[model samples]
Target: MVSAVITAAGLNRRMREDLLSKGMTIEHKLIMDLKGKPVIIRTIENVLESGVKNCVVVLGHYSEEINSVLKDFPDERVKIIYNHDLDCELSETLLNGVKNIEYGLCLCVAADQPTVTYNTMAKLIENAINYENPENIVSILARKETGFLESAEGLGMPFVCHSKLLLNYLPEHKDNLNPILREMISNDVVFYGTPAINELELVNINRYNDYLYIKNKF
Candidate 1:
């Protein structure tokens, strides 16, 4: 069964401070309302709707607040894990979720991306499962350019791969999976990209302005 690992443990240093300055009390971007649902909730629901067998969410920083909202979340497929290191990098948070998954294949998603669609998620999983190599990493690509999949910076989450690949390639110290993914691509590890149907689904909320942009657009 393919499971999903969503990283929601960000410190949100920039987003929190920016929103506070704007006189908004939102503690983190994950809790921000996007089209009537919280960002993280939307992300989780979208992943589940894509037909993953189960999901693991790694929480840190504002874990209590994050957990409070999810306390009554009825979905039995969603599991919550905690990372005590509030200052851990994004890669580490993702790794924490990866380590806890019980499935052979894993889909990596960012909780801040409320706009991500179930259609795009299902497409990514379909591509990964169709590939010959179980080790192949399948990611959603924003552009149709050929070289976009070659670099980690161009590779964003909502990607699918074997759980083993993440256990071996994810670096604990890096802010993101980009550096290690770049190294893996250089080593000829099979990394493929499926073109996103709507690029807006790939947009992530990082700062106050980003939240505003999403709210305004969607």
Candidate 2:
């Protein structure tokens, strides 16, 4: 079974400042409303609907508030882990979730990426399970720009990865996750990219404007 890990630990400094300055009381990007539901809630809902058997949600900065919302999920397989350091790097949560995942592969999904649909997730999981090579990293290429949904192959989230392989590289790793991922790619850990995806599915919420654009269009 391919499990899922939802990263929602970031303080979202940029989005927080922008919202506060604009006189909006939004606490975090994940808490912002998307089609009348919290972004994280929408993300979790879609993931669960995709039939992911196990899920781990990692929360930091606003753990209390976020935990309250997660209580709504009825799935017994969902696990919640708290990251003590609010200023900690993303790798911390990745490691924390890895310890709890009992599966071979993990879906490293982001809480702010609410547009990732059940269909996309299901396809990626199926691909990971049936992949010929155990060393290959499975992923979905989503929108990185306003381009064709058919041709755009921008590297993206909800990435299907070898849990143990990544966990092995966690020790001595520092700062952000990109460097380690790049290092793995350089070491020939090829990413098994899934089929083309809709540009909307890759709209990551980093800034207030990003939230606005997705809320308006999608």
Candidate 3:
């Protein structure tokens, strides 16, 4: 069974500022409407549908508001965790979620990816489970600028690998997750990229413009 760590904890300064300028009063981007559902909820649903056994959602910055919206979420497979440090970096927030994983294979998801399809997630999970080597990481590369499957920074999020692999390195890691994965690659942890159903499936919401773009696309 694959467990998932959904990182929703971050200071939404850019999105907040962008919404405020338009006189909108959203507490966090995760709770924003994506089609007919909240962005985070849609993300969680897709993860569950993809065959993940369980998932931990790590929340920060508008934790209360995000929690309130997700309080009655119907799936028992989803768990919510809190990172009290509002200014914590992305790696720190992911660390909190990674610690709660109960399965050997862990899937790291960004909560802002509301449009990510279950097919894309399922393909990655299938690859991870069927992989010959336990040490290799399976990931999806969505960013075009990065260009290569293996870059200096290594593969980014929406990746699946052993929880021990992340727990072994993440505690002492800092900043974005890609660098740590890069370090792991240098230490013999090979990463394989799973093709995404669509590049738009991995687009994350950072600002109001992103939200608008996705909403339109959806």
RMSD for each of the candidates: 2.0, 3.7, 2.2
Candidate 1: tens digits of C-alpha lDDT, residues 119-167: 8788778877877886665555444443236555556676888888788
Predicted candidate 3 versus true structure: per-residue lDDT over 86-182, tens digit per residue: 7888889988998888848988889998777888888778777777875466455445433225553535778788888888888897789777877
TM-scores of the models, in the order given: 0.91, 0.88, 0.91
Using TM-score as the yardstick, the better of models 2 and 3 is: 3
Clashing pairs counted in every model = 0, 0, 0
- For lDDT, candidate 1 versus 2, the one ahead is 1
Question: What is the overall TM-score of model 1 with all chains considered together?
Answer: 0.91
Worst 10 residues of 1 by lDDT: 139-148
Q: lDDT for model 2, please.
A: 0.76
